[model samples]
Target: MAYCRCLTPAANQMLVLVSRQSPPYCSIRTMFVSTRRPHKALLKTLHASRRRPSVIRWQSQSAPKKRLLNITPQSLLVAALITGMVAAVYIWLEWKKFVHQAGGRIAALSDSGIGTLNWTLTDQNGKRREYAEFRGQWLILYFGFTHCPDICPEELEKLVEVVEGIDGNPSTPDIQPIFITLDPGRDTVEYMHKYCKDFSPKLIGFTGTTEEIDTVAKSFKTYYSLGEKDEDGDYIVDHTILMYLINPDGKIVDVYDKSAKADGIIRGSIKHISEHEKLRRKTFLPF
Candidate 1:
């Protein structure tokens, strides 16, 4: 009886082990486990992982992107290049227009029948003179002020060289060089007299009232403007730098810009004035 009892227990243990190992019994156990312990913990873990914000990663990526957008060297270079090109084109266009307009005006003056300009004004010595007084001679007229910093001196030097060259040539027509002060207010007769003496003994200086100066400037089509007042209420005058070549008939035969060399000016003035004189001699004779 003891042996049978022991055998019965052993048989039950074997039966339980077999049932746990068998597929059908294992499936029934798995079903019981799935139902009793819902996979709630696993599902919740997965949901939390999905809901977790990737805020740190996104912020790190955005910092580099923002830096790239804000600090781009190529953008600055492109902007500067565009600005430089625009400025260059504008300057070129302006220069072209100035040259074209200046050329057209010169052509019109050459064709116009304005003859010559005539006027009378006081010299630096306070002596009255007339443009007619310089008749039968070529006059090289330069309009400027004493206060001019650079251009006036340069033009005056060129004029001196040109007059000297003409005087050297016996065949060349006589050229009476004249210096007219656009700033008569500052350049008094006494100042002009001394200034003229310094330049050349033959250089005649002229000054007049502001109104008279304006009239003369207008007749020559010269432009001038007053600069800003200084600390002492003094101002500068900016005037045209053109040199006018007048024939013996006192007509504005030609105009020379500041670029015309001294030699060229002398040659051109002598040739033009001599031609006019020859023509005049033919027209009027004392035979």
Candidate 2:
């Protein structure tokens, strides 16, 4: 609200003005008293301020981006060291597992009696060869005759299973399963060949003169006795039932008696073989 008072001698008058409701103008109430007229520029300025609406402006500013990966030479070296430590730990764990699975230390032979002796005998192939020819090979030796009906056949079948078990593993060395007949007179080349095939193709049946057979049997510490003959000239040869596990060096490493099963023999063979490989590796040196 604005009031203008004009004070002249004969023309005395009062003027009232009302302006629109705006921020500064609506908040002001004033009375103007003067004998002179108001300036036009001042009036125009007041009118312009009341007619326009107030404006508030806003501005948006961009900020600098932060890095996701700050890679430096020191950081790269630390990462490599951590990876190397993890790899080393993994390798150590694997080695310990292998050692545990390979079984206990293999016992060394006290006497080399069986290792030194070599007997010339006739193989199933009709080839007369010395036992020395089988050197540098693993051997599983069993002494039995083909004529024995029950024990010999059962033992030979078990021997086949043992050999197959060893052969089934690629990491283990090959084994020569030797079957030496106590009665060589009856087990000729052809007869031994057929008999061995009945058990396993890997089996090698050997037959020789009584003196040669005696020499090997004595050296191996095996025993055998001939039973009374029957009407058909068939007699059972009572012999020692054992399997000798010999290493590549021709030394007897272990022996399995009658009570040992196929799985036991298989485990024992693998254990001994793994130990043999470890020993061989330790002894070998490349300069």
Candidate 3:
């Protein structure tokens, strides 16, 4: 027969006692089992299970998700306004720089009696016209002979491109293109009309006597020299390759040299036009 003697749990172990009855002897034995490790493991499992649901529940019930940007019409309009303001500021700075450079040259030209320069010449339509007749209109003036080999044609082509570019934009002001012949002996009214037509219909050609041409050229600060005649009696007239931009008040606003491109000239013209309008407004308001 075997009987349990004692079973007790201590601090970190459990004690088990047993008794056995043999035929002629009785025996007792003690055994020990570790309970602390298993007890701690069970406790840890219970705590983790209790904590898992709370964390998930809190995330689903109480935590708020971050909102992403929604592109509504109002947001788009605000963004457009910001972009336009930046562009306007940049354009204003550029316009200021242009004026700072051009103001001095224009002042010096005005001081040299250029502001009073006027001419009486014949237009391509065989009509006598004076330069003063073009007052109150923006003008781009070029001096070249109809028989120019290459340079005059190229410059006239660029000038036409610029004029068209300006006129093409409805918001921008239109510009009148005037071509004054440096070689009046050959560039007659009919020849000037044909030459101007070859470039652009908007171009108006002018021709006058030697004294009238010289006076206009000098007043406009342009130089020209006739080259030696070739075997076929064809001569080249070398002159300044520049297009003068004049405001409506007959004052020079800007000068585009040979290096100026059509797009650049168009931009410069628009800038000058805007500035001129602003000045006119200030004159009326004086504010």
The Cα error of candidate 2 at residue 142, in Å, is: 0.7
The digit string of per-residue lDDT tens for model 2 on 138-197 reads 999999998887888988889899999999999898899999999987899999999999
lDDT by residue for model 3 (1-287), tens:
22232335454443332223332343443444355444564445445645543221122366687779888999999999999999888867776675565566667767877636777999999999988998999999999898888899899999999999999988777899999999998988889888899888889999988888888988888999889999999999989898999988889988889999999999989988877775566431224
lDDT, model 3: 0.79
Instruction: For each candidate, give its TM-score against the true structure.
Output: 0.58, 0.61, 0.63
Please identify model 2 stretches exceeding 4 Å from their true place: 1-112, 283-287
Candidate 3 — which residues are off by over 4 angstroms? 1-105, 283-287
Q: How would you order the candidates by TM-score, starting with the best? A: 3, 2, 1
Give per-model CA RMSD: 20.2, 11.5, 12.7
TM-score of 2: 0.61
Give the worst 10-residue stretch by lDDT in candidate 2. 101-110
* Model 1 lDDT, residue 183, Cα: 93
What is the Å distance of residue 200 in model 3 from its true position? 1.3
What TM-score does candidate 1 get on C-alpha atoms? 0.58
